[model samples]
Target chain A: MNTVIDTILAHRSVRNFEDRALTREQIETIVRSAQAASTSSFVQAYSIIGVTDQKKKEQLAEVAFNQDYVVNNGHLFVFCADLYRHEIIGEMESVDVLPSIESTEKFMVATIDAALAAQNASIAAESMGLGICYIGGIRNDLTKVSEILGTPNRVIPLFGLVVGYPAKINDKKPRIPLEHIYHENEYNSEHESNVQELQSYNEVVQKYYLERTNGKRSDTWTSQIAKMLEKQSRMYMKGFVEEKGMNKR
Target chain B: MNTVIDTILAHRSVRNFEDRALTREQIETIVRSAQAASTSSFVQAYSIIGVTDQKKKEQLAEVAFNQDYVVNNGHLFVFCADLYRHEIIGEMESVDVLPSIESTEKFMVATIDAALAAQNASIAAESMGLGICYIGGIRNDLTKVSEILGTPNRVIPLFGLVVGYPAKINDKKPRIPLEHIYHENEYNSEHESNVQELQSYNEVVQKYYLERTNGKRSDTWTSQIAKMLEKQSRMYMKGFVEEKGMNKR
Candidate 1:
């Protein structure tokens, strides 16, 4: 198999990192690759905040509920779904951008673009022998993250990417079967895998977590989903997004 | 630089593709790499629809406002932000998934997951000497597209990706200067690039489109944003997303 495919397929989230630092050249090249990702309509509605300040990273770690990767990684990249820049560009060119920027479609466009670019960054880091972790925990407190990042209105810190040389690699987790994730021309929920395939996969997942933690964790995939979804999590995200002038039209 | 980095930096949207068919092995490998992308909380909240039926591609092309690439490529893979499988899994396990599935944060999570997977698919295809074009025009009329694809609630067709051997490669467009896109430690709007960097990049982009089209197009970067953001394009997307039972608290 090719190296790119190898890098992609073998990805595992790395939270542990060595104390060594990444060279500036590597950092520049990685972000350059992120900029090279395909953006919708060339809107390029995204930005990256490179966090190397130890104090700031520590604060962010707290904001992410003590996810130490926010502070312990070689670098932290805050990927922003930014419509603020589009507005500035429009103002620079003497046009109103809000007719679109303030709408849900554009918000999603920006979010999706930010995500695509961040994935490119992750892949780029992996190709360079670096390990990466996507830090969605930052969304637990968007207000604190925004204040820390100085993000203005119309800018949402969608997620963070922590990149470094791996100190430890967790056992790879199994995904749901392909037949359950891929369809032909139409949405197919009637597939046997969709309705009846969870039991086997749940066993796989249960064994994975069980073995990963020396049998300390005994829950299956279904139980985890049940616990996580039993109550509203991150309901404030919708409010935060709307407060950013998105979805307000 | 490595081949992976080279392939990434040389990305350009390819609309014209050589009329060719991809092998089953190649298709399987590409989707496998897509599944390798990280999903939030192991939700795996995404699905891919591979459109091989010529007539179906034609109708999707119409849905995407006659983007010929949607029909003219070697493969059209519809990346969907889907939570239906999670619900089924919940049902199979006899747990409630609606409390979280009905929230907006989950929708964004699924959308981000699908986009990450699609980008990986794009990268894997590119590494294999294939071309790709991300067709966001699928959202221009998602309601009809849903009917065409039989997409049920909680399954949004985020975008379509066309992969093939390129018949013609457009000149790669220049991105905004890195200083504009990447912030250090905090958001830096005072940087010279933020307010004053577009002119030079505009020149680069203008020259690119001008030469690529043989002087047929002369618009600058700012002008394109001004034009695209002048009106509310895809305004119906908000309603469609809500109707799909996403983004509703």
Candidate 2:
């Protein structure tokens, strides 16, 4: 496979990072790649904060459940699903452009625009031989993030991404089989034969955890998810989003 | 700049395509790249339906407001925000995983996941010197898409992407400057100077449209968006999402 395919197919989360800092040029390239992604109606309704401040990084690490890489990574990007930019544009043009909750479709388009742009940056970083990890924990303390970042109303932190040189290479985490996701023309969840095939996958995942952590927890995928969902982590995000002006339909 | 970075940085929409068929290996590699993206809780809540059949592609293009490139492209993919797979997994484990609008966070996560993954595929294809365009018009007729694709409950079509070799290279579209998007700590729309900056952009966009369409209509970015949002395009998406059983908090 070509280098592009290689970078993509061989993708993995890189939490540990080297001490080298990302140069301004590299950061510009990454964000430029992000901006190159298609936006709905050319309304690039998103903003990324390139956080390089040490104290701020430490605070973000705390917010992200003490993920050490947040403080150590060369570039910490907090990607926001921003309606504020467009809102400002509307204000300047003297137009009332706020689509209501009845406009669930517009909301989806804006959110998807932010997400697609973020992934473009991730892919570009990986292709440039940089390691990256997405910090969903940004949502864990959503209200704090908005306050810390001085994000105004109509823009919410969707997620954060930490990018840098890898301190160490890690083994790949196993994903649920391709069949579990890709459907023919319709969604076929009752694939009895695929369910039977998952037995081997359970074993595969069990071995992966054991080998990766050296038998630290020995948790299977099923148990991992069960444990995760059992307790509400960011259940407050609903109110947080509403407070941040992302009132859903 | 390297080829990959150039491919990414110089990215633009290619609304025309040759009739050459894409190889299966190309599609598989792109999908694999997509699958390798960071999914929320490893749920991998997305699916890509690769449309190679001519009749189906034509119908899909029609659904997307007669976007001729979609039907004529080598590949057209419907990217769905899939929750039914996880719901089935929930059932197999005898756990209730019925996602609701009340489960608003999950819905957003799934939608974001789908967008992120689809974007990786788009980037991968682009890096390999392919041209692609995203079709948000799929949301313009969600019920028809669901029916046509045989999508089940909790699976919504977020967007569609058309991929193939470019028939011609289009001029790069101008983006709003970084000063407009990059907020240091919080959103600051106080800089009224952006209006003047946007006037220059309006000129660039107008020239692009005039050159592309032989001056059929004089349009600016604001005019385009205003035209698009003037009608109720996705008027039924809220009720459609509710009908699909995603009644969350």
**Candidate 1 lDDT over residue span B129-232, tens digit each:** 99999999998889888888888888999999999999998877889888888999889765355656677778888998898889999988988988899977
What's the true lDDT of residue B83 in model 2? 70
Candidates 1 onward: DockQ, in order: 0.73, 0.50
Question: Highest lDDT among the candidates is held by which one?
Answer: 1
Off by over 4 Å in 2: A100-102, A191-194, A197-200, A214-217, B99-102, B191-197, B210-218
Runs off by more than 4 Å, candidate 1: A191-193, B191-193, B214-216
Q: Write one digit per residue (lDDT tens) for candidate 2, span A94-198.
A: 666665422567667778988988988888898788999988888878778877787877777888889999998777788766666565455564557545655
- Candidate 2, residues B1-249: lDDT per residue as tens digits? 466667678788888888887898888777887888998767666777777667777777788899898788867888988776555456566665553323667767888999989988887888777898999888878888887787877788888888999999887777766655555544564546556666676787788888888999678876666545545567677678778765245
Question: iRMS for model 2?
Answer: 2.6
How many angstroms is residue B140 displaced in model 1 relative to the true structure, after the best TM-score fit? 1.0
Cα lDDT, model 2, residue B184: 54
In model 1, residue pairs whose N, Cα or C atoms come closer than 3 Å (at least 3 residues apart or on different chains), thus clashing, are none
